[model samples]
Target: MTFKVGDEVTLSTRAGSRAVVEYGPYGPNGDIYLVKLLEGDEQGEVFGALARVMSTPVFRQGDRVAGFGGTEYSIVAGPFTAHDTWYVVKDDKGQHHPHGDDRLTLVSRAPKPVGPTYELDGVTYDLGARYRDKDGDVWRFEVINGEPRGGMNGKDIYGYSETLAEVQQDYGPLIKL
Candidate 1:
């Protein structure tokens, strides 16, 4: 298979992640390729060094590669309740991390009612993402989409957002990259 740097490739198998190529090493013994894989992405690239080429390579940046078996993510769909597992409430008889695990953490933010989904540029994305409610709590909804900006992750799938009241007043939610 032909591949090159700056290529946008996905897993051929059930791979979860995608990446832009950074390096490829080849030699008389065999050919090797290096790719940057995102942690959240599950699909990974695969090819044995001993394999023989059967055709001309034509891979470029943003080309979709197939058949990669990558890691999967556990995206729980729910109104999740996170508790302080380590800190004990003295009067309520609630015990802190009695096992000394010290795994307690504070809630950064919680998500509100995530809305539906939308698509742009032939891509789909979640409606509500990185949401912050009236209480200053933040939450994230997994409206998945493709890697944009050539595999950069900061692009919000929903574009931009406004409050329900603002949206109603304006007749729609604000969408921008």
Candidate 2:
């Protein structure tokens, strides 16, 4: 039984304890498995188990799930297997968290973001609006080729948002110009 990362399997040592394979095939013949226990007193702890102790993950990418708390919903970002397998999940607040599958329950999928443009307060300021920062440097928001762009003193500012509040937040105090 070859166990890959993110595979859900039962631990022989822990009896009915379920775990997800974090890494494996480490020993001489490639049978030792590093897994995170999913239940009992040792829940959430990682341990090295043999190949005969694990199974496979039942969930797939894009699956909606909620943590054991079951309050907030999230989407599975898929398993990341670098040093260990981490089931990555993106929550409602757009934050990602790693968890064992045993700690998650299937839930209704959430809606995806429509696009980059979003309403902040109610007023959508026009592009090309100029503002002077605290340092007295003037910046302007411009849309070139239908894409939002920001420039300060003839230099392009990358990752600049087309919002007034964002401009103020990034460049410090700003006076409309």
Candidate 3:
């Protein structure tokens, strides 16, 4: 049971997202364990999964996940009501999503498609607005190509549905996906 300062590990038994062990009661017999997540999907929406310990953890505290190249974001006061409680993330640039790049331009589409489909664990899923945390850090999301995807931020997890009417009432204005 040898863990390092920034060792990437999981719950080892439960359905937990991947995270880096921040501090491990590290020494001989510490009781509590501290860690920060490494990889995840469906921000704001919580999914169920079990802990499968990682053989190796990739990123760390000093490592950046927002594609900002090593710029660590600080999670300040959030839960902003504009859309939800948005965090006060202080950084050079706001969060960056995996799609907002030269290759995958998230430009609005005319007569936008119903929504983008994201398949997870062999099941197809549709989501609305993909959101970020306080620091402009885009989340692990697949945005709609033409329209905004609709869904709830972490504070608004009740905003999801396979029904178009339900999605429209809850997250229609957010995104096409």
Cα lDDT listed for each candidate: 0.32, 0.62, 0.36
lDDT of 2 at 100: 68
- Name the weakest run of 10 consecutive residues (lDDT summed) in model 2: 112-121
Order of models, best lDDT first: 2, 3, 1
TM-score of each: 0.26, 0.31, 0.25
Instruction: After superposing candidate 2 on the true structure, give the runs of residues whose Cα lies further than 4 Å from its correct spot.
Output: 56-177
Worst 10 residues of 1 by lDDT: 71-80
| Best TM-score among the predictions, by candidate number | 2
Worst 10 residues of 3 by lDDT: 99-108
Ranking by TM-score: 2, 1, 3
Better of 1 and 2 by TM-score: 2
- Candidate 2: clashing pairs of residues: 8-56, 9-55
Per-residue lDDT tens digits for candidate 2, residues 97-159, read 888666778776445332244223564544535556776556666554555555664355555
Tens-place lDDT digits, model 1, residues 1-177: 456666644432212234545566565643555565432322243443211221112221112222113211111221111231111211123322121112212222233344466454454535543333333223233332432111112222253433333332343232222
lDDT at 103 for candidate 2?
A: 73
